[model samples]
Target chain A: MAVCCPLLQHEGERGEEARRFSLVLRAADELCPWVEPVALGSCTLPARGPSRFFGGEARLVDQLGAAVIGALDGAGPVQIGAADGLFAALLAARAGVIVPPGGSATFLSSWSLAVLRRPDLAVTLQRLGIHTLGQFAALPARHVLARFGGEAVLCHRVARAEVGELPGLRDPRIGHRLREVRGELPDVTPQAGFFGGTSAGDLRAAGAVARLQARLGPEAVLTGRLGEGRDPADRGRLVPWGSRPEGRHPGRAACRAPAPWPGRLPPPSPMVVLGDPLAAELVDRAGRPVRVGATGLLSDAPARLSIAGGPWRQVRGWAGPWPASERWWSGRRRRARLQVVDGGGEAVLLAAERGRWWLEGRYD
Target chain B: MFVSTDQGGRAKPDLPAELAARARPVSTAASRLLPLPDALAALFPDGALRRGSTTLVAGSPGGGTTTLALALLSTVSAAGGWCAAVGVADPGVVAAVELGLDLRRVVFVPRPAGAWADATGELLGAVEAVVVRPPGAARPVAARRLAARARERRTALVVLVDHAGGWPFGPDVSLTVRDAEWEGVGEGHGHLQGRLAAVAAAARHPAASPAVHRLWLPSSDGSVAASPVCPASPTRSATTAPATTA
Candidate 1:
């Protein structure tokens, strides 16, 4: 197995340049589904199978180098190596060397003990005068194991290219852990397939909404359903996108009015139902505050009403004065509802309780 | 190395007109016009909602503003088109479903207060049709800008405004519910069922004679059906100004 070691070098490239790197990976995936492709700012591509398909090992390496350089838009210093195992291939790739079959031990022999990646062993090897992999491999396995334990014995075998008995010796996936130090390869995202009619458009729309939700909070995309209630505020309810509508089942109630509450305002629902009722002032022509008596009669006819910064308009016609009181026996609730049209013909729903008035909503 | 920049190089000859025509961009205007409910077919110039155009639907609150708006969106939604409502909190989901809007296909932005215009702009890019109620008082400049954006996006925009007032800016066309009377209710009793409304509409550029029709706006079964045209009242001309509902 031949592994191509792509020189990563620049640390800053992992941030903003990650996108360009992923594009390169995607382009490589399109060319060949390389087994256990590892990306670490730089990438490793095991070239054995692909090398045969592209005509030869040399041709495959050339094509891969071209593809990487193309993806990076001519960024260079892409080095590749071919050998019996990844350990020897990685060492050979650093020197831009390619070792023939059966030459693994000779290829690894010249490398220094530091290439073993166990710094403590490297320091010990240096102190013991075994400065190179060839010299380290010359030491007896039994002596190395008894003195240095199992970890150094394994490193000694890798250094001598005697790794055939080791688990996952030629497996590319073994290098995945090392690749993760920089960053993990993103999972292959699921994509929408071709479908007839507006489904394609719908998927595109859903994608846009998802992106909006990601940028803003989850509440940004909301779904609203009409809920059952006499009060307009309770009538329209919104829930987070994709969730089931809660509260009353809008289909259960025929008129959207709870059965016990009889006098729900008929047709001409307000255009805008104020979440909170706005304070209103209603006075009779004589400048006295108009009040609704206990009998649903006005103590003085309302002459003018003003609400929410809009100019005070003259009252044209009036109806209702019906009781909107809740829990009468508790002594907690008291209010009278009325439908009043201004001189401009804009009708508004008003509730007056204890000489205080509120503009509940306006008819659209 | 000599590079041949021209496509096909010198070796390949231009294809015949019939073959070349296949590569030309096709116009989508005919298919872009969306269907409308049977009752509203006559209101539009093309008898369908045209993409990239704005239509204003104005009526008194509770008088059928929501009903008519839902009716306008029904056909499109039934055809699998996605619809959006901006700055509209509760679209009376019951009324919407009753009037034929598929709830699954609808997206609502309950409180679009400060971001109403921005939200509408975002929805226009994705939805096939959008109904927007201006947050607070309407602004002419913003309305005009949004109208241009709708044209660019090719999304149908239905502006829901109060019939008692005028739109901040003129739309490509306007449909106003002149008067609406609820049926299935008497002086004292009866469950509410449907509405009878007189709708008058005119386009910026007239498609035909002014469209005035009396509609069983979502008749008892929850679908808009045409009713006989009511005689034009003496006090107001349906074509000229907004008619106050009696």
Candidate 2:
């Protein structure tokens, strides 16, 4: 069971709002340890153990309400609701009612189906002549699963007050927002993975990642993935690490050698794939510029190369002008890729498009 | 040379520490060392990545340092150890797979900017290994702090630098990729098939001298393993970078 404190009038001045929120939280903390500040003007906490300590759920709610009202001192109306779950408790607080234990379903029986907050489902249920939550709850669970699918089954559970929490009911960033309101630096963290237990290394790594995210903004920490693409840059993707569930390991899928694709550069993938390819110049032995024609053939063998107009180096070994006309559907330009190794043993992959070459990556 | 120091304080004062270090069996030292692949073991004094030790990988741009550093994390990650990389900008995911890094075990803060030290410090004890490339020259204090934290945490730290002097703190093992030569390609013919990298190691041990090794950064099979010198190869130190394989 959970209890909710919904402040009807705590949002005028910035300082005053912070003051009221903290005071409400302080008062709530005196009664229980797991006080969660859900938003600027609302909070929730577990009621089972605290209810037992205060003799019953009603006494805890009354004591909590009195303490909160005392802290506010006629600042506004304080509606405290105690019920089986977050959804029921939030609505109960809005209605200013203390629903008796296991009577949440009975209390919610009178509410309109719109209170479920799934407007589409509400419209569909209403079309089926189910207007109130009680009417929706009376539908067979198996039939709900069959006709409405898993999400509607969840709504059906919430309609019965069986499960108090729904995925979209609570704001995910409430904690970060509240911290910012308190003039504290906020650390954003995603919800824990479905796995219930974690090892000590996981705990430490999660803490470090969260700290880095807070310090360096969210996008700095990243994990790499090589999806299906012919271009090396197209294949290598970096996603903001720790911003999603990590139970899906990145190993099994990434470790397998890339499945052969037509026009894919052969093995020994480049180590340095430039995010923005640098302009390069390739020329033949006669000091004539080399170009890849529409036939996907080089006009002349590249004998010298210069990247970004740097000093020209003797191309000791070279291969390929493999056609990779990727953007042709939108812009009718032809593109081809070439591999070159200089006398210094530096190997580079270059893409020739629009009669010019660009340094794509380095096989360092 | 991370022998089980259960024999540390005990009466081995006259037993010459070098002898003991060399004689210690692989089994006992393993608890303190992350296992190294057989191909790379010959380059390290302990034949493993020592716990709480800093290893420096220095080379010119495109001189195979990235491949070496990523290669170090492969076995450790395959063994289910967590590893982190900081300041390795624009890492190639396909290449990382080619280098055998289990992407799941590796975390990258590719560009930490001014907070690189803090990020590396925070991850030292947390992950089994941390490979970092400084965005700029590292300060003495920052370098010392990271090295000290790594030493105390039993974490393997691999620092990538463009030059030998780039890292201010002393390192346990310093591997510099002197040069590399691409193989299996001709003048405008075949594609890239392999690369032979010339690597040199300078460790802190008093008796060990700096040694140069020739190995394939990515061999014909697309894996890093030791190389046998090609008999007819010519050394090319005349133009672009440093001295090449003789």
Candidate 3:
């Protein structure tokens, strides 16, 4: 018969707790420099080589427990169990009991079949009055295979204390000695103040943002790229960092200097584009409001426009009312955009929609 | 302004008289001058971009502002130092190749909007040089604050101020492309081959006198080289022939 040693009372999952527990496991590696440790919190280690090295299975478990406790500053309730298979070893560790070699089957014979954690098999066995692993294992192997498949047969072997396939260890060097300590990590965010400062604080801030991204997803931390489009609002595309841009390859498309558009506002685009156009008043010579006709023509010659504040300035060099209409099927609306250079040499882009004039953006 | 007679692109051993006067022990984090390519040396006071200071490059769309920015970034990145660019709407990859910038060492954040300051500050903390543009019309106070942060981190900040409005706040040094004339393109005679531009630079204190140079903003060879000044013109001119390094 082979041996399996299982640990109990694993650490919690918070970052600090996980780090502290990793430290304890690392220390375990130092003590049993050859046994590979498998994880569940309380780690499970194969006891063959380590047992031989430490005189016997009993001494090996005792030594590992002592070493782990010592490394943890004597944190108590370090349970270690050694048995023939993983299932029995885990149960034994939980109960702080060890089954002697060749007596694992006898020890497991009285435990409930539910100990295997196979709910369906346990329920079926219960319905059939087979309440314990001993009773379940006592059934004909052929009959168990025919009914529950190879998985059930493997369970049957584990219940009988016969060594089955082992799980891949989480840490390959679980029982291997750690050669050196990784140098102390610098403070994630150095206390560089708001302007320019230490990188530690910036690094820490980036780390925090990464954590938040992990929780909330990549969409929350957006990195935008300028794309080719006529409307200022549609010109920029916000995408998660590292993701490929949607639609056309906007990057290469806009590489060369674009052809000058007659109606487009020239270079020095607005610093900020208003999400929603603000209502304004466009007036004619007589102080009456200027209106647009249904045919996309101005009701009167537009002479002046006012936005946000100040006295209305006379429009000097004026451009077209490039009319645009969208969502015709849902709820059609028409908007006309005009580029107006005021008498003060200042320029602004204004849009008129639904018989109302609004300031779209500034050319400053 | 002092002038250099070395016309060829080859590196000159002797420093220009003007730069030699301005060359003093710079208080740098590495305690050494941050090197600039020899071609652009005429544009700076000490023949190097001083660390922990801000340099503003402003020009119209066709005025070679991007070329200048990539040129500055290339110098630092080629020397095995990391550099970053924020709010440069154009992808620097295509232009970096033309400017001889090492793409592998340079990091480009194409469009940093509202978080421009934060992003630039972070890059200043880590990279040797950072090139950025104001996401919006940055107030003078905000611009000064960003410049102060760069000083603290010992990282050089290069701002690509728009040619139309220029820099929101005064920079330690400013380079403006006064005018650019395209070459080879005649009515319908030839393709838009390259450009020649007059660049003017002025530094704060001591070097307040503006220095002007006419050069190939991007010569036909896709490299920025010093062009000789027109002999008939009174303005300071480099050699009419492109400066050849070979």
lDDT of 3 by residue, A181-209 (tens): 11121111122222123233334333433
Q: What is the TM-score of chain B alone in each candidate?
A: 0.78, 0.80, 0.79
Which stretches of candidate 1 lie above 4 Å from their native place? A1-205, A214-221, A240-244, A247-261, A327-331, B1-31, B57-71, B74-80, B88-104, B110-117, B133-154, B160-172, B176-200, B204-207, B211-231, B234-246
Q: State the lDDT of candidate 3 residue by residue for B56-163, as single tens digits.
A: 888754356767776776666554355666777544233354455544335556555676777777667566678887765676776888899988877889998766
Mark the 10 consecutive residues where model 2 chain B has the least summed lDDT.
B237-246
Better of 1 and 2 by DockQ: 2
TM-scores for every predicted model: 0.50, 0.68, 0.43
Q: Rate the local accuracy (lDDT) of all candidates.
A: 0.63, 0.75, 0.59
Fnat of each candidate: 0.19, 0.75, 0.00
CA lDDT of A209 in candidate 2? 67
Q: What TM-score does the predicted chain A of each candidate obtain versus native chain A? A: 0.45, 0.54, 0.43
| Per-candidate interface DockQ score | 0.11, 0.39, 0.06
- Kindly list the per-residue Cα lDDT of model 1 for residues B1-246, writing each as its tens digit: 344555434233455785444212111334668778767888888888888899998876656666677678887775556788876764555456656665556777766667778878887868788898886557778888889999999989998887524567778778888666544432213323455677888888754667777776656555677764444642322123222221
What lDDT is obtained when candidate 3 is compared to the true structure?
0.59
Question: In Å, what is the interface RMSD of model 1?
Answer: 8.4
Predicted structure with the largest lDDT when compared to the true one: 2
Q: Which stretches of candidate 2 lie over 4 Å from their true place?
A: A1-199, A245-251, A255-257, A285-289, A327-334, B1-30, B230-246
Number of backbone collisions per candidate: 8, 0, 16
